[model samples]
Target: MSPAGASLGATVLCVLAWAGLAAGDRVYIHPFHLLVYSKSSCERLEKPTAEPAPHPSLTPAPIQARAPPVDEEALWGQLVPAAQKLEDGDQARVAAVGMLLNFLGARLHKTRAEMRGRPGAAVLSPTAVFGTLASFYLGALDPTASRLQAFLGVPGEGQSCTSRLDGHKVLAALQTAQGLLVARGRAGGRARLLLSTVLGLFTVPGLRLKQPFVQGLARFAPVTLPRALDLATDPDLAAEKINRFMEAATGWDLGSPVMGLDPDSTLLFDAYIHFQAQMKGFSLLAGLRDFWVDNATSVPVPMLSSTGTFQHWSDTHSNLSVTRVPLSDNAWLLLIQPHRASDLPQAEALAFQYDLPMWTKNLSPRAIRLTVPQLALRDSYDVQDLLAQAKLPTLLGAGANLGGISDRELRVGQVLNSILFELKADEEEPPTESARQPAGPETLDVTLNSPFLFAIYEQDSTAVHFMGRVTNPLRGV
Candidate 1:
């Protein structure tokens, strides 16, 4: 134990500790490493592709102007029963589907956020988007089918037709994902959420689609209606007809009608989803509250407030705060806000560009007095437009093989997915003077008075059903 020996050992320990920290910092992996295409895949995608196999023809079910009402009880009964019968490798398939959904959802959200000079609130459903994509996969052939299988992160890339993943099975998994969200909301005999999704196929008159393709739509959505319309001859009128039909079918005035109908488009596919949730113990505060749209601009919007111990995380390095609120027993909402009001876009970019689900993993329980805007957001985007924005316009273009959907020359003009998300605090009588006690000093006050981002995810599967950026609560984009 000489002084020289002690000093040498201390110096060595310090160096080792510093080295450990440096190594830890350098051991970082990008979230999208596995999802993005490799150099070879990109090169292969650019090469000339083979033609599609001849599609079989079947008499489609009679076109109906109005789809029958969905029996919620029966629908859930069927979905849950099948979900319980989890086949071997089903977990992997479900996880793959969820990962793809999150990846696509992030890309679509970032695209929408940057589309305008000033980003507006945009809402999208990963479920509906995935369903729309799955529908296309159902009808795709050859290279297109294999390409889609890769894009969707599903197995079955063999050259033989038998190797293609079954669309029915994929769609059924999607329905089961939806089922988990809704079933968990209703787990405690409380109707916290009401979710309805429909698929509308508007085609040119006399266009014959495969019976299996039409029937397979039902496995994903409760209602699938095919109607003959002149989408090419009268784009405006066709848009009006679709708007009215969806309104009548879903009983929710989506606020805006369908737009941007392709003039030459023979088929227009629409997936409309309506989601409403009532937080169990939240209360609607009286009068309108000032929601800062920017540093200077403010708009009055209805606000909801609740106090509870919720999972919360604040990333000082990223200058953001995340709050998790229970939507149901197994589904929760993640609210991400920039610490600085003006940094919303940057915060959003950071959240989506890298790993978002990773943020959820860091959250721990904290007493919070949370106030958020009453969200009534409706957003619709053409999947084709999204594809184009993502630099793959020809993925579903005219040359693509969608022979499985129709027998004749088929061109998918538009695949639009519309989403409506409404969140409200349950109605309650005004609090009495004595009952309205102030929150304790230890309670963290988190108010979403500025632009922010959000997502709703399933617990077990980690499926992100919805993702959005709320720049303006009043806009409801």
Candidate 2:
């Protein structure tokens, strides 16, 4: 117990403690390390040889700027003259066909751009392009066997075009284009439908004579044309029939919905066919049932308030009334904003809070309107006058949550569930003695489940437009 012995022991303890702290800090501060694979093998490893010298004619040329590709311009040049000829007899049909073709070409360009990691332009939405394409085919395009075979380049016995290089060339080009579209992952389902439909129209006996379109329109009325009767009444059945035709025509099972389709694959197939038909100036709606309208149902909601004063707050709001609409089992409370007071913060807040969650991934703003007073005197208005003048829809629709909200109060505005929490190794706990046990085949299992909210918002503003609760949220969200 001498004083010098005590001091020396204390100094040793302090040094060890400091060293441990430094190690802990280093662990926390360390940069992430990425493992890189070595190119060379251990056996017979050698440095790479220098690249072969360029040929005399292929020597490094001076850099020169080149004009951007003008594929669209060239396509238009070929199309305009053909369109003019078609217009001579059926001007409306020709115009419709031209629009469909334009849409198809645009879709093709968009798909190409997406494949090459380019941003898609907003000039044409995919739905509009596909819809228009569908319309053109149903409205203007003939389903004659000769025309169908010629357009698609499919060969048949006694088909003289198949024997020629020109026929083969066009057929190869069409197939190549179709293959490229089918490879795109986003639009597979629509593409599959389009391709199957086209093939059905072409190869199915008597379909080219317009019976299928007539049947399809009658069955699926308003969404599809009735030119082909067989396809109109039972579109899904028609799709199945088309599948059979494709199998017969190509000698391959193109696969059926009964067999599970990977969603990504389906999207690519759908996009391919849609783009192709569009390119050929086909109208999707001409013979198809109105999917959007047919699928929509009036959602129901509890009446929160029914004060007439609320409705008559603005002149625009005078006619506004509340109504409920269903969005799945979940009822949506849609408060249609009035035209004059549409920009009011209160209206926006109400819509964002209630409407967005129920209709997330489905509903979109139907319209937007603005009004400005010309005179300064007119601008100064009472609250009652302003409210009365508001033209927005006062109607509200309600729906069920559809597993969107948790019982627990979540972190305000936190859009994602399952927030990652790093439990750092305890700094102060003493290391435990190593325990050993008899070892054999062992199984380790882990399970995690947490309820949390997710929100979708405009990219620029952090304001949440849509919110939902994830029951089985994906990992690393």
Candidate 3:
């Protein structure tokens, strides 16, 4: 399969393949077995099985902090070819993962808005969040894994091994999806995108992590940093140490101190992503623009201006308009802005209710002079908190089976993922002569001067990679 086709197939298989096979006594299954279907596997599925045997708790292997994993290529090689046959009944499940991310993204923004008691800037990543959950799924066994698979929209087949979903396939699909984004960014000389992901794991002293589990993380994050610290001693000190380590590793000061540290917790997980996209069509405006934060208040922020024919749609029933702009050959930025009279929160609530993917499909080309604020946004939230918001707080609780990750009982304190999205106008070259045409009677001026919602989509799969709300352009830089 071509690289592009492989990415699309992988994205489509994320959820469907998870429901393919159940976990037997084995801890890890090669993603290849789950992705590539054969007559032999089908025949095995047809056979009846005796009573299921309980798998003993897996033994954790000791390894030093920042140790290089052995056989990295062998583990990652399974994700290649990327394309796999997706059953007809399971096709819809292909989009299940993306839709879940959309729902969570909406919830994430809503939660932030409620916390501040006002509209606020928030950014959530579908890829990072999905990958983080999938990584945990790799370490989860039986009931915990089943719960995760269900939440991820994987359908239950049966009680046999063939009925269980493979965590490796889910993770491999995540890698391909992310790879597609990176590959898209590299094409088209006029555009540039920088996306980097890092996973940070902090463990209590003498607590060992499974080597296989750590090795599997290579499917998504290129860098995995594991450190052992005295988390039970002083929460503040521990937080400081974690912050310093992450900052040094990623060169991003997360600003706020890490919160919700449990003294008795043995493990903490944090995933960080830095994403920046720049395209040639838009040019930075010389002066700041007034962005109304509310009916009466406004803030001055940097702005970018672009004039050309672009995909655009105005929702007649609702007080919002949708605009789609190409960031790369394989990606688009869809902007949803509310009318001047409507508040963003109400518009956001209404916007999420509509089929978001349809917005991209329904867009029509129109001549537009678009003005949007230069954005630099960041937000971090705990996965546990997100589950609580989803009313599944105990999904990762003490009783959860994470034996694949470690042998001893573990208290997982936090599962946090931080996202940073930066969109800047490329000013290296002037706009093409056609784009610089003087405003005419047919040109419509659309300015995102107020709080609005935005989503980044992978063109091939039409999957939402990132969803966010921009209340103030300068808030989370």
lDDT of candidate 3 vs native?
Answer: 0.67
lDDT of 1 at 117: 46
User: How big is the RMSD of model 2?
Assistant: 32.7
Best by lDDT: 1
- Against the true structure, what is each candidate's TM-score? 0.82, 0.17, 0.79
Q: By descending lDDT, how would the candidates be arranged? A: 1, 3, 2
Q: On residues 1-477, what C-alpha lDDT tens digit does candidate 3 reach at each position?
A: 644233333433643443242223223234233432245665775667796444343222222333443232322233323324344523233344445455445555565556556546777786777788878878998777766655554433234455556666566656655555545454344227666777888888777787778888877677787788888889887877787667766666566547658888888888888777885579877667799888899999988888888899887677788998888776788899987545577777776531356545668999999988888888887887766655566668887889888877878888988887888877564533332444788998988888888888765444577877887887872
lDDT of each: 0.72, 0.22, 0.67
- The C-alpha local distance difference test score for the whole of candidate 1 amounts to 0.72
**In model 2, where do residues sit more than 4 Å from their true spots?**
1-96, 115-245, 249-477
Q: Lowest-scoring 10 consecutive residues by lDDT in candidate 3?
A: 57-66
- What C-alpha lDDT, on a 0 to 100 scale, does residue 232 get in candidate 3? 88
